[model samples]
Target: MRYNRNEAFRFAFKEPLHARFSIYEVNGKEVETTEGEIQLMDLSPSGAKTYTELNIPYTANNSVKITIHFQLNESTYNFKGKIVWKKVWSDGFMYGVSFLVNEDMQQEIVKQLKIHVKSLKN
Candidate 1:
């Protein structure tokens, strides 16, 4: 299947899953590593939509990347990506992280996601 640069197919879990993330990059400068908990709303091989109570400011034109770590079926996974979309709220925020991964890594993620889905159905 052909991939689209502006959009990606995402998968949603039957139950809520939480993950930890830390600021990895900002305009190529080292950061203090602001870390927080994020609820996984939906996931794709290349990106994810997440919600968190911690406030993360989105900057236009500046490169910002985060390292997010989560587990599925007892295996740990991580990715570094920038926020491509955001929705601010009074108490929390929703952000989309766009990860740049190789095709092999992408396949691994898809394998893990498939296992997660099967477990939920059982």
Candidate 2:
């Protein structure tokens, strides 16, 4: 859960979400649109850890759109992530998701994360 850039925001949600990237999900799983799901772990803004799988659609520097649902209080926010990095591991593939653009929901998450960071700094 480390980022190369400290400017990236991190927020936790109350629940796990079903995310669909601009790529595609095969058989209700996350993967390259044409391929199958590759095991993933160690998620963060900068990168993640994944197991070895063939046809790893995403590359080290490929740009991707990651969509995940986020909820806080009574509001639910949909997130679109831009890929930063992807790495290969003996176990699987690790990936990174970056926020794409500004939306009201994203702004709220950013605001909250900023406050959280500020609190930590204090």
Candidate 3:
């Protein structure tokens, strides 16, 4: 089986990479909930495409704004993001989140991605 999507992250590391994440806020409101693991199928400095068991109902053309927390390269990161898109799959929900990060955070994300990639070669 093969994926035909011309996604950059898919070709970069050539392996499945996952990040444990929690949606800390929804629609600008703080949420008290359990954490859920999400597969970061596509990642970049500005955003990530993730697959997870978590689902935030979307209706009336409202956008889902959330604070996402995750760990990468032994460092924890928190990003405010908007669920730009979503789709329901067989066993999970796929979400495209656009991160609202500063320039420094974007650079940090890129750095971690590079570090992770280098680890794969070892």
Candidate 4:
């Protein structure tokens, strides 16, 4: 499947899921981490977009590795991602995180997204 760099095709859920994220590394240096809660807005094989009440004021195009933790089906899942974009709002920030996944992990994410889409249909 071909995707446009400018336009992203995301599966937006009606009820946003709660997730926690930690910025473990920045510019290859370990820093004091501030854990924050984010509302998972949408999902795709490539990445996800989330909204957080925490004000993470990072410059655009700044790269940082983060781990997002969320629960599904009584099991917790952690995914590694890189921050690609950050938009500041009056209350918080919206982040576009691109998943750093291998071929296998990509397939797994796609599978889970498909399941979520299917469940939403019913």
* Best prediction by TM-score: 1
* Per-residue alpha-carbon lDDT of candidate 1 for residues 39-121, written as tens digits (9 for 90 to 100): 88778888888889987767676777888999878888888889987888558988888887888888887788778778768
- Residue 65 of model 1 has an lDDT of 82
Candidate 2 lowest-lDDT run of ten:
12-21
**Model 2 lDDT tens row, 43-114:** 334322333344345654454555544433445555555556666655665556555545664557656545
State every prediction's TM-score relative to the real structure: 0.85, 0.45, 0.74, 0.82
The C-alpha lDDT values of all candidates are 0.79, 0.46, 0.69, 0.76
* lDDT (Cα, tens digit) per residue for candidate 4, span 1-122: 33446534466768888899998778767766877888887777678888998866466655587889986434577888888888876588888888887778767766676676676679
Put down candidate 3 lDDT per residue, 4-122, tens digits, no spaces.
Answer: 35422322335435666555666666766666677767678778777887777644377666667777778888777878888897688888888888889878887888787777789
lDDT of 3 at 18: 65
> What's the lDDT for candidate 1?
0.79
**Least accurate 10 contiguous residues by lDDT in model 3:** 1-10
